[model samples]
Target chain A: AQTVTQSQPEMSVQEAETVTLSCTYDTSESDYYLFWYKQPPSRQMILVIRQEAYKQQNATENRFSVNFQKAAKSFSLKISDSQLGDAAMYFCAYTRAGTASKLTFGTGTRLQVTL
Target chain B: DAMVIQNPRYQVTQFGKPVTLSCSQTLNHNVMYWYQQKSSQAPKLLFHYYDKDFNNEADTPDNFQSRRPNTSFCFLDIRSPGLGDAAMYLCATSRGQGGQETQYFGPGTRLLVL
Candidate 1:
């Protein structure tokens, strides 16, 4: 069984600044996927960014990026030029490369963007 | 605008009452999934349908059931609602299962069991 862990339960970042949410996972599979999902107050889950284990280059999506360290089993999300809209509960998820593989998610980190 | 749509964004049901949540996708994806998320918690997979094939998680309670009549529609049925069952139920879809395929999610239905 794979487990994702987000050590920080809450994180705060000033507007226009940057914030990084840490995530770590335990998985023996070499080929897997890591994802960061944002759930706003409306409770709508949105995909932030994703990283493939085999890809050495980190994945970047607009202001959202991931620091994927396969050797350390760490996949952290970094939000740059953060805006108030970035405030939400961020979750780190893992899935093995296969058919019908379910996602294993971290506890979550609540991000707060303050002025 | 291909997307996943969940009906009755908010629902309130009495204890032991039966409730059903519906999900429809315009993406015409082959895979549809159901997830349960409690307050301040991550979304937990309950079950999923790959076309007509149903896959349920091992720990998923039998109280929860699912139906996928066609390619576009899927349903989540709670046989007997309990207070513990109150949570946000989310609907998601994907083209297929793989590392590159991304799962698109709906807004979700918040279920309140009284």
Candidate 2:
């Protein structure tokens, strides 16, 4: 079974500053996928970024990026130019490559963007 | 735009009562998943449908059931609601079963058991 871990339970960042949320996973599979999702208070969860285990290069989506270290089994998300809207609970998830594969998610880190 | 839709965004049910949550997708995805998320916790996968096949997680309670009438619609049925079952029910859809396929989520239906 794959398990994702987010060591930080809560984090805070000043508006316009950068913040990095750490994530690590324990998976035996060689091929897999990693994802970061954000859920605001009373809002829907949305995808932040994704990284494939095979891809050595990190994935970047506008202000959100991922630092994926396959060998270390770590996938961290970086939010640049953080805004008030970025304040939300972030989750890290992992899944194996197969049909009907279930996603394993971390507890989550509550992000607070202070003005 | 194509999106995942969940009806009855908020639900209030009494203990032992049965409740059903509906989900529809306009993306025409091949997979639909049901997840349970408690307050301040991560979303936990309960079951999913790949095409017409139903897959349930080993740890999922039998009290919870799921049905997919077609590619565009799915339903989650709780046979007997309990206090522990009070959580946000999220419906998500994906293009395929690939590990990298992005899952689009619905707004979620918050279930409250009184």
Candidate 3:
């Protein structure tokens, strides 16, 4: 089974600043994918970004970028220019490349953006 | 808008009563998944259906059951509601079984066991 670990339970960043959330995963499959999801107070989970295992180039989406080290099985999310609306519970998830609709999730990291 | 839809955004049911939550997807995805999330916790996978093949997580209790009659509809049935079972249930779908396809999620059904 693929397991994702988020080391930080809580993180705080000043508005317009940057923050990084750590994530590590254990998987035997050679090819897979990594993801970050944000759940705000509305409790709606939205996709932040994704990384493919085969690609050495990291994945980035606007303010949300990922530093993916495939050899080390490390996929961390970096939120740049954090805003007040960025305050939410962020989760790191993993899934194999094929025939797997289920995602293995990390415990969660509560991101708080301050003024 | 064509997206994942979960009916009854909120549910209030008596303990030991049977409650059913419905999900419909207009995206025509081949895979559907159900997740259980407690307050401030990461969503846990309860089960998922891959083209009618039900795959339940090992830790998921027998009290929880799901049915996907067709490509567009799925249901989560709690045979006997328990206090512990009260939580937000999320329904999601993806075009295929692969992880990179992006699983679209519904707003979710918040179950309250009284």
TM-score per candidate for chain A alone: 0.97, 0.98, 0.97
Q: If scored against the real structure, what TM-score would every candidate get? A: 0.97, 0.97, 0.93
State the fraction of real interface contacts model 1 keeps.
0.71
lDDT of each: 0.92, 0.93, 0.91
The residue pairs in collision within model 2 are none
Best by lDDT: 2
lDDT of 1 by residue, A1-115 (tens): 8899999999999999999999999988999999999988886688899898889999999999889899999999999999999999999999998756578889899999999
Question: What local lDDT score does residue B33 receive in model 2, on the 0 to 100 scale?
Answer: 96
The two-chain DockQ for each candidate, comma-separated, is 0.69, 0.74, 0.68
Worst 10 residues of 3 chain A by lDDT: A95-104
Question: What value does the lDDT take at residue B94 in candidate 1?
Answer: 89
Ranking under lDDT, best-scoring first? 2, 1, 3
Please say which candidate is ahead in TM-score: 1 or 3.
1
Candidate 2 residue-wise lDDT, A1-115, digit = tens = 7899999999999999999999999999998989999988877788899898988999999999999999899999999999999999999999998655578889999999999
Kindly indicate the candidate among 2 and 3 with the higher DockQ.
Answer: 2
Worst 10 residues of 1 chain A by lDDT: A96-105
